[model samples]
Target: MRASEDAGLRDRRRELLTGARGRVLEIGAGTGLNLPLYPEQGIVELVFTEPEEPMARRLDERAHARSPVPRVVRAPAEDLPFDDDSFDTVVSTLVLCTVGDQDAALREARRVLKDDGRLLFLEHVRADDAAGARRQDRWHRPWRAIGHGCNCNRATVPAIEKAGFRLEHVERGTVPKAPKIVRPLAVGVAVPA
Candidate 1:
């Protein structure tokens, strides 16, 4: 089931990242799973922010293995170690739900992105359905304990909007073979207005 869920996530991530170009910053680059999916054309450079030491090491190894090496930094999303407006694109995949402070992380993402820069995301968020929402609330506590503090109940889209981004495109749906309660996946692009 986990494998199937991961496969679904990979497909969705690929679709969302297809047209990425220029300097891109990817938050929570866990194990660098998204590294190989990046588009070859248009993208000039890639930067990854990962706080976990082990994961960062793996990401570094993956970057070095790539034809064009990507920059990998060990840092938290809420406090980016970069100049303001430093990237043409910012991306987060399955990241927002585990952030210690979603608003702060989002603000950092907005700060690093250029005025017209795009924010692309592939996140698993709280369900909009009432029954599903209830189920999510029930499962989230136990899930968080085992899933590295990740919550299935975080409303990622609204949080992004509240952090001062204008949604340009959005597609939400359930990931295959996963519990409907916690499988509300949102893929979209936003920009700071």
Candidate 2:
């Protein structure tokens, strides 16, 4: 990734996570990159849900190394092991693109979130432009094969809406200098209905 692209992702991630507070659950907590971006003052606790064993181990290590250790759970997004409305906030960064069943995962997210709880996400999604979308469709097959099940052309916004959450805010833009086929990043907050 280019420096600009990395910075863009970091900025978008931070923006989505800035005010995250109360009991928080992060799905697909890969390597715990969002651990540091979490706000120190408002956040009451951090819980991470990761299914991959290797990535879970890394997330555990990272959490232990951080100032505030986060609770880590070994689980998939669609099958989260949490009580109903357990978290005040649910977060997913660069995650929905890879879930085997994105709709199920989003529904689970809403299921675990409080009625007024917020869902914050920073995701690389399918492009809105016709030409760019065409390219994304063309590259998705090979991309999924090599990128570990990640889809390059998911309509994340509509999917989130279909999962029963109301979109409150959304910001769509490119990850600077990244490949056009997978460049549209959606950063936003949604509320459970």
**Tens-digit lDDT string for candidate 1 (53-146):** 9999999999998878999999999999999999999999989999899999999999999998999998889898888888889988898997
| Model 2 lDDT, residue 119, Cα | 97
Residue 157 of candidate 1: its Cα lDDT? Answer: 95
- Each model's TM-score, in the order given? 0.95, 0.96
* Stretches > 4 Å off in candidate 2: 1-5
Each model's lDDT comes to 0.89, 0.90
Candidate 2, pairs of clashing residues: none
Q: Write the per-residue lDDT of candidate 2 for residues 1-193, one digit (tens) a residue.
A: 5474476777777877995989999999988888888988888889999999999999999999867789999999999999999899999988999999999999999999999899999888999989889999999999998778989999999999999999999988887777677789888999986
**Candidate 2 similarity to native, TM-score:** 0.96
The list of candidate 1 runs beyond 4 A from truth reads 5-7
